[model samples]
Target chain A: MKNLKIDETKYTPEMTFDPETLVIAIKGKSYPENTEEFYKPAFEWLEKNLSDLGKKGLTVNLELIYFNSSSSKALMNFFDMLEESVDNGDNITVNWMYEEDNESILEYGEEFLEDIETLPFNLVPLKSRE
Target chain B: MTDCIFELKNDLNKNGIFFCFSGPISQDLIVEIGDTLKNKMRLEDASKSSMRLVFSIIIEQAQNIIYYSEEKVRPWSAGVNAGSISVGIITVAKKDNSYIITSGNMIKTEHVDKLKEKIEKIKGMGKDELKQYYKSQRKKDPDEDSKGAGLGLIDIARKVSKPLEYNFSSIDETVSFFTVTTVVAEGL
Candidate 1:
């Protein structure tokens, strides 16, 4: 297993996933012209990394400043993958973090938590900053 | 008669719309309006949570127009963009026990149907299920860049009392326009 890191940019977020910790983190804005183009590789990496997940545990930290509708579809696919991984005996925990004053983002975290009941999910609060 | 128009004004004692601006938007514009609206909300005693919803809707809708409006024109500033963006919200507290903050803007026609479908699906979802769906989408296509992924409307619909309503008006041979509105109750 290996680790992958996609550094942040003005329009993109910081993504860091470690196979050893089974932790995946995506934080920042997402309005990429080709979302699938960017995420396809990440998904593929996860697929290969989790092939023998019978004894592995995974945790993902999701935080965002903002994302376009296009990015939203990609996010759904990411969650579905996590659900599949959990089903495949990979203990999965998703920690959705949102700013304290950003009620919409908080509710967003809550909404995602509702979709997947098969895995462990946490809706955590982060301080709002300008 | 001229009296009819005058009478219309007399009968409709207005609040003098505090602020209204329309057409292609930008992040700077959003931030500026956010400041103004936040001040207004504070003055009106609107709950922090409610204000956040309204603010988020503005960002979502404005960004939608900036990035997806089909009637796009070459931006005024090179490299920067200006789509069919508009930002206008009016809040009227009626005697009928309803506080309405109605806002709408033009959108691309091609992006409408799937948006409607996604809103409907969200309206039918229970709270817990809505969260799960949101998460699933997050995990599945974390880089959701499709013009139609439409998580923005889904998130907004989850706040409204009913499904989202939209309209597409034929603007010309090449493009159609769109508008979306969301209504939140006073004490929901």
Candidate 2:
């Protein structure tokens, strides 16, 4: 499968789905007017790649500063898909990154993990680069 | 100059309002005003999380206008990416020790009752209950491809320090003006 890369815009996040690397990274803000339209491709890619990547394991990195409620719902669906992959015996790890000292963002990550049973989800605090 | 205009400014000043906008709201405008608001909050020494909370509410309110407001316009006549626009009023003001964000727009008269019920339910929930509701609502499928989680107001209700305030004023037989105001305590 080919990789998909979408650059970040003011109202949407950057998305990188790599079949070769077995990694999917979504970063930045997300509040698109059409949440389904924005996230459709990622879901499609995951559906196609989950089987192949299941053998080698996959890593998903999420580094979101802010997302609208619509985006939040889309994210929950995406994680559910990932959980399904794990249920099918895929080795998946989700790394949720948030700014240091921001417990609210961290809390969101925790909330997302509450329902998943098998995926190894980690909340990684992002330190300032400066 | 117009005396009434001066009086309006005075009225805003009397209420401790520092920023206000009315008319068309687009994604670009939200980013511009949101950046300025974040900078102002930083200058005021608001905590990082508080700034983020205020900014998130701003985006949700702006998106509510863009997606659901009855007053909409097409900014571009033709393009693969042409977009529709929505008009609304948004204001940020200070009341006592809290920061208040208010958004006003027009909605179909038929939607007023449902909106009222939703807001009333959110207003009655405490923080933990709000969190539980938000989680369950987040898991539900979107009613349509165009619809969202339909939880913006509930999410806003979660961040607020007190009960949310809202009003509906009839403008015609078909539509009404809807306004929602949420407040975040200064130190939260």
DockQ of each: 0.28, 0.82
Candidate 2 lDDT over residue span B1-188, tens digit each: 69998998998899888889998898789889899999999899888878888998888888888778899777666575776678899999978878999999999998899889888988888888999999988877645523567888888888888788999999998999999998998877
Docking class of 2: high
DockQ of 1: 0.28
lDDT of 2 by residue, A35-120 (tens): 98899988888788777887698898999988889888988888888888888888989999998877777988998889667778
Cα-based TM-score, every candidate: 0.61, 0.94
Local accuracy by lDDT, each model? 0.63, 0.86
Candidate 2 residue-wise lDDT at B89 = 92
Best by TM-score: 2
Q: Which DockQ-derived CAPRI band holds candidate 1?
A: acceptable
